[model samples]
Target: MSSVRIILNFLSGFGVLANIFLLVFYTFIILCHRPKPTDMISCQLTFIHIVLLITGPDIWLWDIFESLNIDNDFKCKTTFYINRMMRSLSICITCLLGVFQAVTISPSSSLLNKFKYKLKKYMISAFLFIWSFNLPFTCHRIIYSGAFTNVSETKQMKATKFCSLFSMNHIIRALILTVATSRDVFLVGLMLATSAYMVIILFRHKRQHKHLHSLSHLKASPEKRATQTILLLVVFFVVMYWVDFIISFTAILLRMYDPVILSIQKFVMNVYPTITPLIQISSDNRIINMLKHMQSLCHHIFKWR
Candidate 1:
């Protein structure tokens, strides 16, 4: 189990480093030009990547417990708080990305289209709202475990009793678990539904294009490709989320404390944000073109343009 935890930590660390490079690359692209909706999503995902990159190192350090002495209780509390907040924020942002894509692909005549303009205007506000809504939970996390104490010297130290990530009381713990589970389920359902609707609409559009057989509609291909890209993202979300949820659920149910399971959970949770920038780069032509243009500019700049 220890060896397994070490391997998982290595993989998670690798993921964090990869995400950092991708985030910086995407940031360069965004700085060079105005970003589209997909680019905005990538920007938000980059923020998530940075958060994970910082916290992932702490988790890796936590896994190698025997090597170093973590002196401050505040460090533990801060790390715990940041990790939980970033995880929740990532989940919320991914859900927003799905809904945003759904809205982007929606037909002008569709009911969802009525709010399309509103969505565009208030997209940043929506992001802020979710972040604010999650603030209380993040703030509550700080009250949990603080500095580590040597339990061997102080045999009477009730570490688990005094310091908990969440309430240790059975009822409160159950309530917290229920709420978290339901929230995740709701977001997943919304993403799946929106993705499914987009798929159906795209299918119908393709059928129409097939029947028309008109060479004038070159734009149809791009639209179809965009829809496919979103579908792929939705699939990625569902699979990653389910895997993480299952592991977490099992640990919660069995009261298991295996470090290996914890490492796997962290890896799975961080995987989506780490891969998200790449997905945006692959799926959006605007970002790709912007990146190419930036490369051209960089070369000219170095040549003293």
Candidate 2:
């Protein structure tokens, strides 16, 4: 096997392991007890993460097979289409998670609250819309041609899969790039603005005091912890996603098409989903307390009965 093959295999294996760990952690949270709406959204994000992880390995595996001169056109096109679609869906769902959390934290008197009920009602519809909008891009995958094989190099030549644009003309490429970049920027901006609002609300809440007893309880409350967790999550997402955006933009401008850059992009994208479950678990004290209380009650009931 060539060096490229080895690297691809390594990344594929690592992604698989990371996704498995995330799945197990999410399962533990679910088995412990039912989760709140926010945690449920986080759990859904984890499921998307698992799907990405499972599909991620195939990209690398395809690269390995190509390097080793193994041709499989059917596998190439299928993997390419599935991977691209699922990855796009993952990105969309992640953005949705951020938006949902932000809305959930919005103050009751804020204008955003006026449409809060509509937001909840259209959550699934919005998700469906995202998927539908992205489906067209992936539909061209069916007509994608596998890479040409080099018969001189090896007796058993392998066909590689490359992203085939239905229209590779300058106009199409420019339009697609514009749309993708704009979408990403809009989502990132919204996320940052909402997070900033949340931080301001938290600071104001902290500065004000109710009664003495209420103040003491609030000081040691789960709400404070949840706020801290959300802040941390927002920070984590901002930093990671910014790094990815910078790298991606640089690559696009420089016209540098390297596998390493692609690999890093994939890694960063996958990390958010995997780590989301942990954030949800740590942030929600109610879930933890409920789990413990249920266990205790079960033990006592079993002993008495």
Candidate 3:
């Protein structure tokens, strides 16, 4: 395999494993304790990332499906559609996470304070709405994508090794692009606004902390840490997302898949998902505490032996 393929495979493997670990950890917490609203969101996001990685073209899911003697059109349509859906859900959930955190950290007198009471209710509603919203917008993928036959005379563009996107009429393509772009723009804009608000809130809180306590006495609260982690993830996501978007849009416009560019885009696309779980694992006190508890238990068992 080429170096690019090797790296992409490694990333897919790591992302899948990390996201699975996170999914199980979050599930354990939900079952063992009164789950926080953010816990549900994090769990859902982890699950989405796992789906995204598995269905991702770079992961060779299509090749496996082909080996299974699955119908070409069926394999291409299902894989691409699910991958697109999960990608859409990934952004929506991440944006929601940021907005949710911003509301969570709002001061008692802030306008967003009212949401604290109905956070869980709103979270569920948001999840449903996002799923409903993205499902239709990305349905175009199913219509336009099929197995790649690579006829030199055709307008089909290779989306993956086995799947290609057939050209649509200009008007239909424009409408789909507009709707998808609008959704992405709105979500990304909301993420940015929430992130900026979070930064300001953090700054104000830190200033107050300095006034009320000595530097040595100051310690970050769980909410603050969660907010910081979300902020980092959001910022990183926006960067990676736009880079992926630009490359994809360019490819679509130029009517060329350019293997090297596609490879780079895939790498960029996977970066956020790959790092997301690691960020949560490292920053989340609960995960850290759980690890410590397991370590202590192991030590006790070893000592007893």
Candidate 4:
């Protein structure tokens, strides 16, 4: 395999394993204890990313699907549709994470304070709404994506070895692009707004508390830590999202999908998901404490044996 292929495979493998580990941890917390709404959201994010990575083209899944002898056009349509839907879900859930944190940290007097009580109550409903909202928008992918039979065809954009996007009429393409772009712009804008709100809340909290205590004595609260983590994730995700979006948009506009450019775009697309679990695992004290507790338990059991 070429160096780029090797690197992509390694990254995908690492991302899948990390996400799976994080998902298992969150599942344990949910089933064994009183789960926080954020935990549930994070768990769902991990699961979506897992699907996204697996469905991603030129990865391990292509060989598996090839072995199953599925019809090439059917494979193209199903894979592209699912991948597109997962991407939509990923952004929406990430935005929801920031919004939830913003509400969680809102002061009692703040206008967002009312949402604090409803975080858990409406969590499931919000997820359902997001899924329902994004699901229809991506149905266009199913209609346009099909097997790539000819590289000489300038109108088709090859997404993978088997799957390519067939040309749509100019009017249809423009309408679909507009709808997709609008969805992304709205979600990303909302995500940034929520992150900014969280930053303001955190700043005010620090200013209010700093006067009463020494800087060393002002340990960060769990909410503050969670907010900071989500902020980092939001910033990282936005940067990655825009980079991937530009590559995709340029490809669509030019009606060309160069292999090298596609490879780079795939690399960029997976970066956020790959790094997310690492950020959460390293920064979240809850995960750290849980790890410590498990370690001690294992040591005691081994020693007793």
* lDDT of model 1, residue 73: 60
Which candidate leads the pack in lDDT? 3
lDDT of 1 by residue, 1-305 (tens): 55655665566666667667666765776797665666666567667766765565345545344255554465566666777787777778877877887888788889988877888899889888988977676665676456545444533222221223433566866776788778888988998898889888887777777766457764656656766776787779789989987886686665542456766776687677656656656766765787799999999999995
On lDDT, the stronger of 1 and 3 is: 3
Every model's TM-score: 0.77, 0.69, 0.95, 0.93
After aligning candidate 1 to the native by TM-score, how far in Å is the CA of 203 from where it should be? 1.0
Clashing residue pairs in candidate 2 (N, C-alpha, C atoms within 3 angstroms): none
**Cα RMSD for candidates in order:** 4.9, 6.2, 1.6, 1.9
lDDT by residue for model 2 over 142-226, one digit each (tens)?
5643443543443222223243223255786677678877876787677677678778877777667543555465554665576
Error of 4 at 115 (Å): 1.9
Global lDDT scores for all candidate models: 0.68, 0.62, 0.89, 0.87
Runs with alpha carbons beyond 4 Å of true place in candidate 4: 212-216, 298-305
Candidate 3 residues lying further than 4 Å off, grouped into runs, are: 213-217
Query: Each model's number of backbone clashes?
Result: 2, 0, 0, 0
